[model samples]
Target chain A: MTGPHKERAVTHTRLDVLRLPLIGLLRRRWGRLALQIPLLAAAVLLVIDGFTGPQMAARNLATVAPWVHFRGFVVLVLLLAGNLFCMGCPFTLPRTLAKRLSIRGRRFPRRLRNKWVAIASLFLLFVTYEALDLWASPALTAWLIVAYFAASFVLEAVFTESAFCKYVCPLGTFNFVYSTISPTQIGIHDPEVCRACVGKECINGSYSPTPLVRLDDIPGGQCEVRHGPEGTPGCGTLLFAPQIESNLDCTMCLDCARACPHNNVGLFVRQPGRELLRPEAWPKRWDVSLLAISLAALGLVNAFGMVPPVYELQRALIKTLGIQSEWLMIGLIFGVGGLLLPFALALLAGALSRALARKKLSLRHTVAAFAPAFVPLGFGIWFAHYGFHFLIAPLTIIPVIQEFLGQPGDWAAFSSTADAVLIGLVQGAGLVLGFLWSLALANRTAARLYRRDAVPGLLPWALLLLALAFAAGYVFSLPMEMRGSLLMG
Target chain B: MSFFRLIAVGLLLLAAAGCRGQAITPTPAEKLSIEMAVEPDPARVGEAALIVTLTGANGQPVDGAKIGARGDMSHAGMAPVLAEAEGGQDGRYRIPFEWTMSGDWFVELTITLPDGSTMTQRFDVSVSGAGS
Candidate 1:
């Protein structure tokens, strides 16, 4: 097994984002707090608007900003950067203040540490959005924002670290899943420094009974050694820089960077989806596998909900089943599309792989190990769906701002046919790129697992990936409903 | 802290506070209520009749109002279908519009009252199969 130092030395080729002068500013003590203030203000406005503004979904800031603008931007950012939205999330700002007042520092429940709760939460979020027509209701969307704040505050006040972000938040789970492919990750600048250091400050924040003086107050702004009652802080997630693996649990809060006494932690740029290839970084677990598979299925379900065929299918099902409740119809569609379909596909792939490899691997273990291969295609579908909304009405934000100020402006001109075609091309490219990358990953996994004769093992997974990609490609080709903005009409 | 330092900190706090503007609540005089119905419920993907009954304060239907309506897909970037209707029997206004495609559509109505006050309301319309 490679030691932490060897891992660091090998991974040193990654560009250190903190080395940049601007990003380094975030390493300061108040850096995150400073960035959060404006976002918190925006959240406050959104909640207020939701309660007081016009009931129309498009005419209010409450609905447009979150559903239209925020969802679009989150996916785009995940594609390009690391989890920057989490870094700027305002939901946790209240928790920060509450912790300062009185913190119990309780640990999250041991039994509930897995991603099952989070996966369930994510599924519920998807179901509710469709069933309740959440995007069409400004007041409900506003309350969702309020509920997020309440949950974050209460959970963080009870627990010591970011329990909401790490264990419970559905949005965080979405970020965690998609961010597996993000190009940047927080890691150690030098593993040697961490190995020699006495205090592991990154995971544990610098603690003192009394308020510690800022290092800037001293002759030199930087401290050469750890001293005084104040101890350097550490990663809130308890991840040691040298041992930290993928972007799965990382919120990119940079607490580690600020807390490292030896200045070992730095945000590094690596190949996108590099973590998917590294099994050692994150051990294969049932929950994460289930999450990945569910995400893949939900990606299709999300896209299909917007297209014509699903609507037609729903109508046919309703007629045949004589289902009186529209909610039951929606429930059936989501259950089959999101849950049953993907689970069946994954089990089939695992069985095929086990049979082909001639190995004695447990079906569950094999499925868990190979589930990460589907992340790229899942992320591709999300990108295409959200990206379409973003590109088509990037300027929807303008009218929202105007309406908030009591001067509702005319809706901007609709995007040109050429623009729509260009977006479709980009979406197609995302699907193709994801397919190719997933194929490479599947092959690599096969080679690692089966050795010498990996091609036979790879074939089943390759076919599954191909089917997913083609389905996504077809969905992208269809005319989708752009539901969140008033600008369209 | 020095006077200048205090002022600087105060300015920073003020700037942060200014990020969110105050919420504006419409007064009773500014509030307009509207009720709408789309015929051929689950209006097929073609021409459908839209009936709107505009009301002012006290739940009274506002008669002699001029109405203009525009319909398009809920998502941005589609050509809009525009229609105009005059107030009819009992303050009911009727406008016939084509759905064009089967999906979620929003019909936005702008009503100009007899007093010349204009108010707007949006209705969500779901259209299914192609028209007969």
Candidate 2:
């Protein structure tokens, strides 16, 4: 109880991003829509190019933009900010429209409401991408975009309030998991304002009586009598600001900010991965734990597939197993890497953590509680992988754009030695930073759970993190196969 | 207005714009026309394929043609995989080559016609993984 270790209250400082004028602009009703329109237009153009333009993957917009630019920027933004891509997602626009048309609004099934569906979808996405060589087939990539739109439209048309984003959508899950370490998050400016408000407008949209209409007479309105119009709606995922803990389920749509009648919601800056340490704030669920660990494993798996060893391994498996279809072989690889291996590691770690903790916790609870700690390392691997592609061929987009515009241009002319070295260094630094952050989160979780005997609880998880870090480092060291890019073979 | 209603209107506009298809003009014909078919239908990585047939302007097999074939991943930075063949019987030149990896490979066939005019045509081939 002496020195700096003496028990004392720790004060947290937060910077309200809404205090800045630019955030005020983004919070407006049309703000997100304005940003989404251009993206939708780009999607439409990609589809057109995929269907009608040159079949060459390098020359097609569908193949280049999503695999190279979009994936790269998503990880970069998730690291720097919160889930900004989810905020401006164009796919949700159709869902919003379907809602307006009074499409049937049914609750998402309680049983299917966990992360299992998303996890399965994520695995399927990975397997399909590799099996079909989606990145090398512009037409298939284009159809994938169409499939996304159709799925969003159909899902939202039947269910109410962003079921596609919350319970489904692999990309959404990816963003949600990685954004645990994001520097920015939507938060309450003052908890007192939320306490006094009768209407939970942050989850349910704000409502007000129209000047001409009686409060009780407006049809389909929230008011007991009736209200003129349902004012601006709140969080699409039904997150209330005061109760919001982690970025786990949040899409960062900012509808919560728009629906706050008291202007109390604001985006705040805090220590990255702060939520992973706060187990009390989030519910410990088995599905989320599996999802987190699988994501971490899949991150390495995805990177591993591109290197030469995976090809050699696949060849060996083919010889040993006598499997004729490559899809089956790829599926076997995905099953081991994405599901079986990760689950085994999580089970072992959870067993150890339960054994060592001061308080008796269920194995599932212990695993779920500690799973968020793996996100930083998972995101680091992804960042390194996608960042390498982004850095080495940053200007690949220029020629792709030119080709899309019916102009002849050289997409292969963008690669160089110095750029590759610089990118490698940056990726290496990312891996190091990610590993350190994951270790810190693991330590924090251990200290919180085990108190005086934190070392025992921390040991197993630390080894897991170290292994993951080493795997990521080895992956980055390998010569990566840059699919769909002309600049990097 | 309900936020959904506003969004619905915006979606209508976007759908309209997205649905308006542009007329696709045909690309002008190239000076050299070469049709490449890999034997065994879908090519597999690490297996040899016989790429046969080279036709001239009149769509007939160009006899006595000197053909040089070079293959590489569509992406840059890798060393080129190459093969060459002169015209055999019926003006058909066969270049047997193997794909090192499973992905999109760009193959360039340079044909030196009987009249000494050289024409190069590039093609994209999808090579499947071994055991496919």
Candidate 3:
């Protein structure tokens, strides 16, 4: 890979880059919180619309929430820009305001750093969702919105800094993973410029209440990216720009680049798909384990809403357990999904690791490597579930809402089941496509690390397909009585 | 030989069994019917009490069924009060229609079946003003 580029590598020092005109604009001191205003407004509209606007029971419009459409578009924008979503995520608004704007709040303790717990809790969330019909119930859906706000506020209060968005948010994880396929990344143009810099203000909280940097002190205040201040912590997120293998941990706050004295960091487009191959640095076994389990749970939850039996089981379980629905549901979720599924996955991956590696690695390492393969399976399943909603639902949601609200409205309903079936087929096709794409990506990564072909490493793939096929059958067996009712009259 | 392989094998076997459990064949167009239930009130409709039952082919209760009907009392000299109820245990369904000074009142049931299928049925009955 090293060639003419290495020969032409200018290796510009900190003093030279600081004086450059172009580097100045790239590391400007303006806080990008301005970017989040539109996103916050959209989230507010989604909340209100879920309550006062009209019940999504209308079937069609209910499938595609205003938030999902907005989420996809925002992630697209983030993919184009550098960690723009983190810069302006509304989930972080409360924390930013509290620390910088308010003086009365207590500082969040560091010992309480419980990202793994948060990740596990999120995994348990999807499990509980599986055992319940929250997705089918408009009432529960409304409460989920309230829960997001509550969790964000409390986490911000209990933990100082952007703890919730950085370590806890599932949507943040989703954004980070999907953003891997994104063409843009945050990187440094000159490492020499970064090394000579003093007073790394970007991470040290030296800049204004925000990350904006002044032109006169551009180079010195810049973020050290990978490292923080000599003694103090640099890059609270621990992302080192000069040595960053991938854009995985980058929040794209631009604080590091903005705070640098030499204007060292630059958001560059060196290669189109290089980040996909880079191995993860922070090997948190528990984090990887939870994510693998979460990926499976996400597919099940997405498919669960479409199945009639799932709802029936949910109602029966609630009646039988005789517990408050939420607690019962949460317990069932953790018991089955969080605990059982991962145990099953770990066992499966361990066997494969032993089979292929010819040596006994700890269950942790086996599970982590096996976890990436499941990513494809998860993406495939998501495509199958959401793809159908994305296509056929727009046609029916309007009229359904109008009919329920007793108001006259303009909307087209599905003329036949064949139409619905066609949509399902399209969704199935998407799942297949995603499956293949992930398989290829996983193979490449596995081969690079494992040093042989990845084809033999496809045992997990076969298992995922079997699981997904079962899920599809369950969907088909749904009382399916509600199929036509989704259309507005 | 390993624990993980055992779980995978077990889940796969379970899934295979589920796949073999039951196969539901589609009923014929005529035999497949959706029924709606109505709460019966004898006092409101005069002595001519006839339960309005909507069916396709075989008597299958079609949930999520849609129906529309009106009483044709001009021909019978007395009208009957017809009403529909949410489907219940006995698989009976209902719709509301008023049988006025009746001769013969005709009822129509337009139903959208559970499987995204649609079927319509109609019933006609003779009515008299309390035999006066």
Candidate 4:
């Protein structure tokens, strides 16, 4: 704490900025449902409007809510706060219903209890969105929401654990990865308080009849005795308050805060993106590492799909390879450009890091340690693309909602800012900031790993990240083919 | 460099990208008025046509205007459909358009006057889910 004014830890102090008294409402048992109920109602309306109302994406609730507003807001909230999206997740309530009715189902298969499945699901989702043009189809978007709820119910009903949020659910997994960098997290007020407490109700729901504390649930969700009262629930994902290091798995459901008997767990604010720099922030697993890198790479592919160059690439590939199906070609791009190529780069970077540091650590550990450096850039690209839609068309949803409510909606109000220079510049700023954050994270991780050789070890990954940021910039600079009078070449 | 310095560099990059050049589209000096009639009275999904009555601000018919049309949904990312018009007598232009999906669409008319003067006008229309 003693340093020059410039070097003081004023900026780095892990003080609880968001104190317990500040978020008293959310710390209540049903606080989250107050938010979730409204969103669930909105989701239902979106589905109804998508299916039976106007089929136009812009005019329909399904297309506008999920694609534009939800996406933009999720990223914004994640970067600024934490996984607030999952706190009020509409699917969680329906999943809890399954938990209540199914009478404690069997445990999720041990072999299939990793991020690998979620990663695959996210990849498939990216491919489906582009190939099917899901963004433009309200019906399809509505169906997708319906499918998410159905999947949530079915998975929760069949599993003894909260398998859907932990091992499955691509959206949850995306939020989990990005949440690592968010500022606020569910944490204990004092370690001594947690150490002295016998009934760890944070992970174990506050059940009636002197509820039993399931200590086994504190680590890996093995303690599965779901006999809690109707109103009370704990960390459904089985994350202990005291042991929770990052926002990687916690859903930010505030259930932990509600369930903590000691009143110790609250939304404490910490440094954003600093969690990723922790030496043991993430487990040294290949699936976790690959998931982190893939999302970043896939976001680029997703953004590239909206630009004009992608169509030209598709046409060229079709002509040269005689590919008949458009979906198949796009799938190839996603699989190779999005998944495999980035993975290959990650492997090379891992190898070079080991070689430079003269360390013989396993490649899996090296890659896993460095994977977090990629998250910010991926989030940046996503923010840039989704934010563009949200910012450029801020008044778009008003007209759509009006039309949905049986009023004569003014489409003339559906005007864009038409300020390409300003919006593009904003997009560029977000992206570059993300890239810089990633670079800083990489350097810090390297320093932790290789000490004196940190500079050399981080070189390869730095280059790869720089290339990614450059690609993102180029795509942002290009005339993106969009609705209205945007990029109409 | 320190973390803060890197962020400062990123902001600088934004300032640089802000100065990036933009394409300037030239507009013809004419305040033309256009009255559009969708072929099927109320617009519906499927094969549709736009019959446009074009007139100059000088209160005369703009004859033999080369009319090109581009149509897109009100949202971003969908591929726009382009079409050319068939010129008729007395500044009337007929452009065939298809509402592939039932939704809100905006169609921009690229009007090339007989004297090679070019102008553009955009119209927003809602298509009912009635036709094929």
TM-score (0 to 1) for chain B of model 4 = 0.84
lDDT tens digits by residue: candidate 3, A360-446: 556676555555545545655555554444443333434434433445433323211226568666656655654565566556645
- Native contacts kept, each candidate: 0.11, 0.04, 0.00, 0.10
Model 1, docking class: incorrect
Q: DockQ (C-alpha) of model 4?
A: 0.06
- Model 2 DockQ, alpha carbons vs. true complex: 0.11
Worst 10 residues of 4 chain B by lDDT: B14-23
TM-score of each: 0.83, 0.79, 0.60, 0.77
lDDT by residue (B1-132, candidate 2, tens digit) is 455565565567656645544434434334556778886678777757656676656876667777777665654233345678886566566777877656667887777776767776788777766666
Interface RMSD of 3: 22.5
DockQ of each: 0.17, 0.11, 0.02, 0.06
Q: Candidate 2, residues A276-384: lDDT per residue as tens digits?
A: 7778655688888888888988989988888767867877886899866767877788889878988899899878877776558788777877788788888888998
Stretches of candidate 3 off by over 4 Å are: A1-31, A59-88, A101-115, A127-143, A205-238, A247-249, A253-263, A266-276, A280-284, A309-335, A395-408, A412-422, A441-489, B1-132
Best by lDDT: 4
Kindly provide the TM-score of model 1 when superposed on the true structure, using C-alpha atoms.
0.83
Q: Model 4, which residues run further than 4 Å from truth?
A: A1-22, A208-231, A483-489, B1-132
lDDT of 4 at A317: 79
- lDDT (tens digit, per residue) of candidate 4 on A1-489: 112222212224445533546457776655787677667767777777778775667667888888888888998999887898898888876665575575656888989888888988888888787666788788998899999999888888888768889888989998999998888776666565555555677876676645343443233223433334443566778887777767888888887777776666777777887668875658788898999999999888888876667766877877899877756877888999888999999999999999999988899989998999998998998888888877766766776677676666555546444376877877988899999999999999899889999999999999999999999999887755533211121
Ranking by lDDT: 4, 1, 2, 3
Candidate 2 root-mean-square deviation in Å: 7.6
